[model samples]
Target: MEFQLDKINPTKAIDLYRGMLKPRVIENKMLTLLRQGKISKWFSGIGQEAIAAGVMQNLNNDEYVLPMHRNLGVFTSREIPLYRLFEQWQGKANGFTKGRDRSFHFGTQEYHVVGMISHLGPQLGVADGIALAHKLRNEKKLTAVFTGEGGTSEGDFHEALNVASVWQLPVLFCVENNGYGLSTPTNEQYNCENIADRGVGYGMESHIIDGNNVVEVFTKMKEITESVRENPRPILIEFKTFRRRGHEEASGTKYVPEDLMAYWEKRDPIENYEKALMDADLLTKDDQKKFTDEFNEEIKTHLKKANNAPPIESSIEKELADVYQNFEPKNLPASTETNHIRFVDAISEALKMAMQKNHNLVIMGQDVADYGGVFKITEGFVDEFGKERVRNTPICESAIVSAAMGLSINKMKAVVEMQFGDFVSSGFNPIVNYLAKIHYRWNQNADVVVRMPCGAGVGAGPFHSQTNEAWFTKTPGLKVVYPAFADDAKGLLISAIEDPNPVMFFEHKALYRSQRSDVPTNYYTTELGKANLLKEGSQISLITFGAGVHWALDVLENNPDLSVDLIDLRSLSPLDTEAILSSVRKTGKALILQEDTSFGGVASDISALISKHCFESLDGPVETVTSLPTPVPFAGQLEDQFLAKSRLEKALIDLANY
Candidate 1:
């Protein structure tokens, strides 16, 4: 490499040296703070500076870089102010997250850098989505993301790589193989010789590079990045390195062998580069002393400023602010003129209208582009819009949703479809943990609408048929919508697209083509966090959503003697307590119905709220009608029996008699 340095100028050598050294200085400062108990934790990138420094110097400014926890060097090389990094550690309001995120878990869109989430694998898909956006806009830029060698073992890792490979997305997947996944050694983690070997399985080009050599890392990374930007394709790079420190400040390097530690210390990227620069006469003793003196003074200034800055403000009140999209309630135009349309067609209209209104809105799901989705709800969408906008993705549920999150964090909106709502479990982490918490944690709205074809009774089996409203409702910062009417479906979806938040929309599979209504042809928005009064009665209030709304209405409509009010809760998360309590007060009885399993389901929350708020008005105990607690059986008979339709009828009869 020194023989190769004749062509490299002294300035380039110094740049590489500075890049590798800055992060080490920052790491030492932060670790010193940790020792003084000023900071709670420290995840040092002592042995891994060269990888990020090399990549950051070569990447285009507009391209995105999704760095993991150990990639502090990447952030520093991107020219993020040193004091801001200190401010983040000090938990100041001026930090990137405005005091919301308390640790080194925030990023700046202006710099095209995304900070790490605890689960590192999901960010790969997020980076892929940003690259996809560049491709769509014909921007000559790519996104680079890094994860640990251990992260490739997660399901999301494979899903993200596969999606990027299939789409030929311009994403660089760098695996910093530091020999251990926490305390677990690489030998125990995988049977493969190297993590890059798995790249071929995903149809991605693979390379293994010496991560400890700053020059080698820079030369290879720059070449690969240029190629990827020109001809969009995901590439996998395995950086062979060693962690010089423990996993965090709390965990010392007791697990590391003495000999292994000695070997890594000798090959330290900064030390090696400094010696090399001196040998080439590109750096001198005085130059090194100058940097050390300046860095020491700089650290003191930043440390004092950060410590004096106000600590991050945290409260229950701030958590709820900006959790939902800000919008003024606009009612639908009242007119007798309406077009009779299927529920599926109504959804299609909503998607079409949303996409037409905003060119940035893109849809992704399995079989959606050519096959119009499994249920044919998205039929003719590809013909109307190009395949770029209406994409048919692989069976990578996690990437599908996670990528939408990435797109949403940018200026774009994404409408992601889960072929069946039950399959959302495969992608649940990103939706529940990352997507839902974005706005609440950092005020970053992932403007994504996940379309879930939900519910059972059609005997699609346990894996395909499920009503998961309860799972999402329990999670704060997510908007759960399950509309009963085609008109409400169109309106709610439009509002969801416009709103700057993550929304989990449940479209009942049973009603896609079976249900029909005169949906409004004109543009409109149904207010979220509100309920539609389907029927008016003084005897009992039937509160339900999704398929159960129709089921409850049928039970009461046939029995004209029993007057019942049907309140269709369109929004599940922001529970329509105003409509619910008002109906219960007037009717004097409350009946909660849902297609989800009875135990710990959406109805349970509503029932508890009703009991607590309208207990005095109740004639008998609050009644809840729901399916039995079991996997939705494949056999039609068993599924029907498992669903408590007959039990609901009996419950209604007993309530009426009571």
Candidate 2:
């Protein structure tokens, strides 16, 4: 598996350059169309066409590839239709994304091109997950991820590389280092002379190549890519080139220094490669003219076909149809068959069970495997499932989440663990933009669950302790679930895993080892978009969720005269409007309490919904109580005051009076 650069045929190099030039012509024509207001925006992969096309040429059509926005050159090399590229640019129905995504956002599962994600480095992690799944299933394939030098600045890029390195994943990270991230040069991004040096710190094989040298790129990358597929490992390929176009259609060249622009313009990949082919005697002036003429005609034909295609129907039906494909109720063993266990243990057991059922299930993230998770929830499962299935990922949060999104889209269930809920924010882009929105947008399901340990009061610092339920609850097409008791935890988790849409499963660290409850002794299941009435009373309805439910229960038990109806909002997104209205009708009063901040919180949403639907039934104003608008204090006295918990009996009496 040794690479011989000198052995590359001159004729093949000429052919490769010819292939690269077509995309550049397409980019130039599209830029003209963009200026005419025929296209909304365009991110040209102009000067780096050689690297994009060369690396892509080595990729098999059956293998997966995740591209960034400026990857039309690479995508064209992989046989993506030129007309569809124009249709995408025009935001037409026949576009690559079915008119749902912008020109830069596209996908084709049939060709194993996972997606063209607009969000920076997040897609790299997804590429890693897809590769890991292929390795586990013994599905002989490779995943190639192409990104920009600017993407390396994102935390996700580090996360993805670390996971791929630790797991020996079959993924090739191709960084198209085109001198500048828009107008900012590489010198401003890092102190290192080359972007490839970062790979050394991640324990990955690294290579630096002349991006404009199509021959060298094709020859050098072929063996490295082959080696990765043969024995699943990761490699980082840094292609040093320069961009000849502005960042996007609206951005002008004013910010770019005249000298730098002139220097890169002279070294443009399209023109330089054309000259190289003529020098090598593989192509004559007549041959170049004939090829160029044929390519322009090809582009015109595709554009005509793409523009004539009918638009994709944008409706609510589109959202309903792809939530789950072939969704049948899964056969589960009766609850009586399994022994009684703690909530955290049940969650671990569910992971084990799901992995055994579906070979596509992959568990990854920081300390999830041999360490059994920071809370010891996944104990001993790594030994049973092996390191491949139960993987211990690096401390890269963005990569872990993005990789999970990629795996999910490719029909693998990626159950990733975030060491803490606070770190989940690091992977927010992929979670919200790709994983969550993809289902509703292009009728694609990113079936992934990001397991986060949340809540507070267990002595974790302000950094470690925080709840982000509201953050995800507002996002469309995403499911958010929290468990109260041991049985609910297991049932909810199983349901979350079975769900077609992406879900954020929030597990309270405080509840993991606090106290055990009596779970069901027989078969039981939890439904998505439903709530539970923990207690039934008539005085007032107390709407709460997560750790706040426990706080509500304690107050009700202490006060006999309160007669409060308490509801546990298990699923936050598709709120149980019927149950909410029914309880509010009987009680004629309500109160929404939570441990998170009162401003722009879940409580506010509940109040808004209630005000619209149950305003006529209200005896007085709906009381909403929540934590103070500040960070969770470390001091016990300060925490108690900041927390939304009311003093034992008196608060319940006060609520009943209202």
Candidate 3:
């Protein structure tokens, strides 16, 4: 595209010049502060302001924007006060994250901009989720997201684009190819001549544009945005540009050749745009000087005020207060009529009840649609509720959860089912960083539930079976529930869906069909953070959750002569410490058990907590009975030795003697 100055109105040209200058001046001012050691670090989009101006200028106020670290011009274009930016860098409470997160990592619903987590690929999936939500709700707004050439190397880029294409989502992907990923040249990054070439593989309309020419970007973006608004589709645009400065204010670009730097310097976005506007008489010298002065003065004044802002709080108590969500829920009343159903059937019934109650509820994951999921937990959900709500996602664990995060925040609720509990490792970043902390960081509810089918005992091997509740137990703002009974599975899921928090609901794989009980047919809400006592005794207290609960019950059933109080810990994160301490005090002994490996697992944490709280009540040392630290072996003999009932019985005998 050629530089077409006459195509844009004079008034619009002046606005574009002002928008381009805002980031240029502020970044320049921050560089001086960086050199003085007043600021720690800064990422500048120095020579690529034109692409930002063009892309942002055409966006509808309601559409969502997921910006990269270099897209600070988005904040400027949205009219976010310059003081807030300065306050954020200064770590003040007035910042979007309340001094919690730094740099370009804060967003507000009012601005329709999502604050990005440090990971690049997850946000692309989140953007796709936002676009999906808009489409499902029939909202006219589209979604615009920014990425770099280096980001295209990540798998999430392909995953996000593929899903958006299949769904025909209204998303605009702005890929800014600035020639270098850190110090590595574009030639070393990818084999393709243009980044846009990859878009064809995903079935998207992608194009390469002259990023230095603001008019070109503006015209192309406006046309594409207009068409997307009328008939939604994902579009990928590669803005070929450069960075005059290095990676950051402090990191020198020594790898950049001297000649290449000189070449891009001649085409600086702001400098060239300013001259073009002056030549066309679209912007007067007085207006240009005033705009420059305003940016300069704003930066200097806000920087001083930000420096004088209140210092960060050092209290651990206040910090803890920001960790979990505290909300008043409208609990659904229970029904007395009962029906016999299996554990898997009860979960499906729970989903039906939840979706029927709330129309906005959706279930998303791998093969959950026609395939009915690997466990057949949600086999008929799609036939009941259309495919829009019951989606069969690609084999993208991170994308599924990350997109669910986006969907849940925008007046929609999502239940993401991980195909296997062991696969949660791939999606750990979204679960911990974005989903768990969003509410604590900005007081916004991350209303989503992750249904993790966990535990071993059925010979599903290590990768197919795992009890991952302990891993997420330490994450703040995450609720971990591992239900062992049928009634609790249905009741707790209803409660989890209604509760405005990110909950990791672990359904035991062995219990899905092996356990069947007369669960009530009507909807009910079982309170979270409460323990279930199957049987009461005073000799020794047996504390466990998930498949361990079933094993503990069996141990008690077999040893009728032995006395022990069996406690099923439904919620692992917000542990029922009161019940645990009371039972241990009465019994004067504690035995914690789990199918998890011995090292750094749930059993170890329970042992530590009991030792710290009720040391005087102990007649014998608290023992943690867990499987050996080995991968769940393939051979039946190895698995039998790994999770033998004899081991639990032996530990019981040892505790009884003590």
Candidate 4:
């Protein structure tokens, strides 16, 4: 597309100049503050202002933009208050993150901006989710995301682009090739000629624009954004620019050649745009000076206010309170009428009913739509809910998980399935870093449930079968739920969907088909932080979850004479400490069981809690029965030894006798 100045009105052209000038003014002042040790740090977008200012100016106020650390103009162009930005940098409580995070790392729904994580690439996947939401709602809006040329190397970047193109999602992938990734030059970062060229591989239109030329960037972005709003497909635009300053003030531009710095200095975005505006008679030299002075004064005023703002108080209660949403446990009446069903079928029924009730609920995973997933949990779902609601994704766990976070941002609930639980390691960053931290970092609700089909019984080898719930149970702002019975699976899944925070719902593959219960047919929800006392006895409290519940039950059934208080811990993160303590207090002897290995497992934590709280009441040590510390084997004989089911039976009898 050609740069046409005739297409832009005088007001928009002047606004564009102001947009570029404001961030430059802010950056200069911020640099001064950094030198004076007033602010801790800064990522200067001094020469790269036009890319954010020009592109963001073309976007509607309602459209979402995921900006990187350097895109300070994205905030300034959105007209986010200068005081708030200053407060954020100064680590004041009045900022968007309330001093929880620094700089552009925090996102605010008020400004329709999704802040980038330090990892840099996950936000692209998040953009896919926001765009997916827009397409589902038939909204004439698109999400724009930014990254540096170095970010293009991440798997999330490829996964997001491939999936967006395959789904025809309306996303604008903006890559600001600022000639360096920190100190690493463009030549060292990528082998490709241009970042835009890779867009062709993903079957998307690509463009390269002069990022320093604000007029060109503005006119071109207006055309591209309009086209995307109407067509609703992903487009990649490479904004060719240079970093005139160091990546951050502490890291000087010593690596950049003097000639290279001089070359980009001559093409400075603010200076070039100012001259262009003056040439078009849209801005006078007097107007330029007045605008700079006005911005300078405005920034100084805000900086003074930010400096005076109160620092975040160090309160343990307040710090703990911000981790998760204050979700009151709902106690719905248990259904009198019930249907006997397998655990897998119960899960399918719960999802089907939830989809029927909530139109915005979506399910995404590999082969989940038509193949019903590897386990057939989502069988016939695509036919019932249609492809839009029951979507199938490529084998990109990272992208799908981050996309779910994106969906949550738009008030849409998402369920992401990992074909096997062990694969969650592939998508771990987005879940632990982004999804689990989003609520605490910003007040964004991550209404997403990641279904992990886990456990070892079918000889599916180590990759396919493994118990990994311990990975997320330690992460704050995430709910870890593992259900053993059919009815609990149905009710707990319903509750997980309704939750406003991120939930990791683990469905033990071993129990999916083996377990059968009279599950309620109607819509219902079970409280999250509550445990069920299956059998109350005075001898020993068998605390277990998932497959261990069935294993313990089998042991109890075989030895009817043995008295045991069976406690099924439904949720792990919000562990039902009250129930565990009550049962252990009554029994005097406690035995914790889990499918995960003994070291660093949920059982270890529970044992510690029992020892600390139940020291006076306990008659013996709190012993734990767990799988051996090794990967699950494929052979049945070796697998059984690894699972230690027989050990659990013996441990129960010995603990009960003690």
Against the reference, the lDDT scores of all candidates come to 0.85, 0.78, 0.86, 0.90
How much does each candidate deviate from the true structure in C-alpha RMSD? 1.7, 3.1, 1.6, 1.5
Model 3 lDDT, residue 218, Cα? 92
Q: What is the per-residue lDDT of model 4 for residues 1-658, given as tens digits with 9 covering 90 to 100? A: 1235687888888888888888888888888888888788899889998898889988998999999999999998888999999888777787888788999998989989999999998999999999999999999999999999999999999999999999999999999999999999989888989999999899999999999888789888989999989999999999999988888889999999999999999988778767766777888989988999999888888888887888777688987888987787566666799999999999998899889988999999999998899889888988788999999999999999999999999889999999988999999999999999998898898999999999987899889989999899889989999999999999999999988889999999888888899998888998898899999898999999999988888898999998888999999978999999989899899999998987999999999999999999999989999999999999999998999586988888777677
Winner by lDDT between candidate 3 and candidate 2: 3
Off by over 4 Å in 2: 1-6, 9-11, 255-260, 279-281, 310-313, 316-340, 520-524, 647-651
lDDT per residue for candidate 2 within 1-658, as digits (tens), equals 1223345686666668777878877877888888888767787777877787788878888888888877776677777777776777666766655566686676777667766566677788888878877877787688899888998887778878888888788889999898778878788987897889988898988999888777778878888887777777899989888777788857767877889889888877767767766666767889888888888899889888977877656667764655434355565544555555777776776677677776778888788888898988788887888887787776777777777777776678878899999998877888887787776455667778889898778778687878889999888778899877777777777777877778899888888877466665444457766889999998898888878888888877767677778999888876787888899999998888878887999889889889999889998788888888899888888878778884424555676775
Q: Which stretches of candidate 3 lie above 4 Å from their native place?
A: none
Model 1, span 389-433: residue lDDT tens: 999998888988889988876678899999999889988999988
**Residue 249 shift from truth in candidate 2, angstroms:** 3.9
Candidate ranking under lDDT, highest first, comes to 4, 3, 1, 2
Stretches of model 4 off by over 4 angstroms after superposition: 1-4
Q: Report the lDDT of model 3 for residue 518.
A: 85
Q: Which 10 consecutive positions of candidate 1 have the poorest summed lDDT?
A: 1-10
- The digit string of per-residue lDDT tens for model 3 on 428-532 reads 888898889887677667889999997777788879867767779878889998888899999999999998899999998889999998898998988889998
Clashes of each: 0, 3, 0, 0
Q: For candidate 1, list the clashing residue pairs, or say none.
A: none
Instruction: Write down the TM-score for model 3.
Output: 0.97
Most accurate candidate by lDDT:
4
Better of 1 and 2 by lDDT: 1
